[model samples]
Target: MIEAAFRVLKVLEESDTPISGEEISKQLDISRSAVWKHVQELRSYGYEIASSRAEGYDLIASPDRLLPYEIEKHLKTWHIGRYFDYHDSVPSTIGVAKELCRNKNPSELHGMVVIAEEQSGGVGRLGRAWYSPRGGIWTTIILRPAIPVDHVFMVTMAASIAVARTIRKFCGAGALIKWPNDIYIGNEKIAGVLQEISAEAETVNYCLLSIGIDANISEEQLPSGVKTPITTLFRACGAPVDRARFLAQLLREFETRYREIESGEYHTIAREWKSLSLTLDKRVKITTPRKSFEGEAIDIDEYGALIVRKDNGKVERVFSGDCTPA
Candidate 1:
């Protein structure tokens, strides 16, 4: 197992000197040959292990890959991210998560996560395309909650809060949530959330709560023709924030807020979301298929609709639109 091999690596790292295969086998309750095999496995994963009959095995270094063992090691949650699937590149993690849940029962995908190092055709709300290059967090969480379809948008809200909180603590960015589902730092967009639902009227089956963040990707790696200015945690912090650690923290925060939603704490979550919102009280333009209007973002209702006070003194509830700050 990768986790066992990672444990062997941990032992080698903590040991001041090289530890013999016999000692490792005794510690792990396995044969010396098994320990050697584990060492070989670690080596295959870009770990430089120095082996010698006289000294034993020493960990020289580890590659900066997003291994499951690394992410699971720091993950502390009841359900979220308990089962993770990682990929170097994919068309979309959301697509993969939807397919994964399509074959399983509700209880089977309570908190399954599908993560990708890069997404070629990542999706966003309103049939928009998301720009997801490498060195970013592009993952989708599969949730089969018992909530009604009207309240399902809260999943995206919960994920937004989770990402904002994680960036605040981990990357120390004063991250703010744009109305509906986007994260911004100052005036630049840093992350976005897209929730794809499979529902019929008031009933719901599953939801793919997908989030994409520019965690470590440089500005150069971002799509050239991006509409809005973008920045990353690496640019903000002057160093690369550990993606595995941030993912673990985000999952933990998300689980906490997700339980609140399940317990009917919508107002509580909305209050927190408002506190970190960049859209509230700001002049904004909402574009729908029929028409577009300018308004002041008043508040978010219980059903996650944006209540806007228009310039014509008419208040409008925007369920879905391309919200742009004016």
Candidate 2:
């Protein structure tokens, strides 16, 4: 019922003039009295609706909260954010997404986005602690793709591409994709992607693609002794870009790339990913559990694995590891 009320409010918001209750009732197929009841309900949700004799109703202001109405207002993708679960504060968006996948129907919940304004216990890649301050964009996207388990890593590549493209589009064209899911602006890290999946023997059930972008977070908010190098959109661009707009564009781009992957168009994204890659043709050091090698990143394979040609005339394809350019 609250969602229905919000839908009505959104219609009123798009209109240049006021909307009458009768018109709303006719459009929604609800009675005038029901529309009045929904209006009252909307008011309780912190929506200021102007009710007068001349104009039936008008939306004055919506609460500055991360509600589905606000998120959907800026969202542009068809499936990426069709369902949203927003929280003022949560332990972790990825945690919530994982729990949702277990309890709910995964097939019915495609593109469900979990967003938190503040995360109390955010987790990063490889069990690292992620500092999710209030101003940053901390969110996770739930996806159910029918792809082979081996190709699941492509989702992380898609996310990295999305974040890098978003930063470049908003800030400038200098943004680049660091190896293994990090976005870099010059030398400082601006964002990162962490892809978690639930799978069976040889098939993936669902994937929780979490992305953390330092939009307006300050340096003081970061923890001590953990600084590799970090930069925010505010610091890079001299001003804070609109988070909603950036998220919208990011989701749209991600959806496009994700669909391409589903359609076996990995070569297309691979081409773009290579062009935008910061690791390609650069001397780098890759560290894995078994061994570490210093080499030059030559290309990324169709499976999104990094291919590095070492100094010893040996070529290696890395599936997952930490990469640092030498």
Candidate 3:
């Protein structure tokens, strides 16, 4: 309902003259009272609106919140982000999305996105707590793709490609896909992707694609106990990038790649991932739970494993591990 109110305000913002309540009601297909109520709601959200008996409502000033209307104005994808849920703060977007899936039918919930402005209990890969404060992009996309469990890792690859492509196109940042699920800009972490799946008998029931990016975040906005140095798109470009438009670009890229995955075009996705890789052809160390080894990351296998050839001429296919420059 608030999103609809924002749409009404947008109509007023785009107009040079004051619009009448009956006209707003006609355009929005609502009653005149409803338009008045929406104007009140807009006032509650810090939007300054002027009204007159003859001249309708006029948008005076707008707030800097990531309202659904902002994203909707820029979003152009077919399915991705078609049903978006926005929050000022949440424990985690994944948690909200999971609960939503649990309560609703999965088939009807495809491509629904849960996004938060701030996360109090955000999580990362390997059970690490992510520091998601204000001024970052924290989002989780709910997908009910028909891909099998073995091919679920490809979703992560698709998301990585989306983030890297968006950073390059929007912020002009030379972002690279660090092996597995990390985005880097010259050795500093800028973004990351996490996938949570529900499977039964090697078939996926649903997939949660969570993405985090430090788009406009500053150093002080970061929570304490951050393990490594981090950089934001704002810092990388010396100015803030438009987060809403960037997100639309990312969702478009992701939807395109996702449709490819559904069509069994795994080879194409893998080729694009390799093109954006930062770990391939580099001497790297892999740390699994059982052991750790150093080798050159030669390539990634068909199943998304990092193929490393060790110094002793032994090649290993690592399905899950922490990678770093050796």
Q: What is the C-alpha RMSD of each candidate to the true structure, in Å?
A: 1.9, 3.4, 2.0
TM-score of each: 0.93, 0.84, 0.93
Q: Residues 182-264, candidate 3: write the lDDT tens digits.
A: 99999789999999999899877889999999888887876566666788989988888778888888999999999999989
Using lDDT as the measure, name the better of candidate 2 and candidate 3: 3
In Å, residue 231's CA in model 3 sits off its true spot by: 0.6
Q: Point out the worst 10-residue segment of candidate 1 by lDDT.
A: 62-71
Best-matching candidate per lDDT? 3
Question: Residue 141, candidate 3: how far off, in angstroms?
Answer: 0.6
Candidate 2, residues 1-326, lDDT tens digits: the string is 88788768877888778889998899888898988999998887678889876888988877544567776667888799998888878999999998999899888888999998889999987888888888889999999998788888888888888888888888884888987888898888888899988899888899999999888777788666765688889888788777777888899989999998898888888888888888999999999889988998999988889999998989999988899867
Error of 3 at 213 (Å): 0.7
* lDDT of the structure predicted as candidate 1: 0.87
The local distance difference test score of each candidate is: 0.87, 0.86, 0.89
Which sections of candidate 3 miss by over 4 Å? 20-33, 50-56
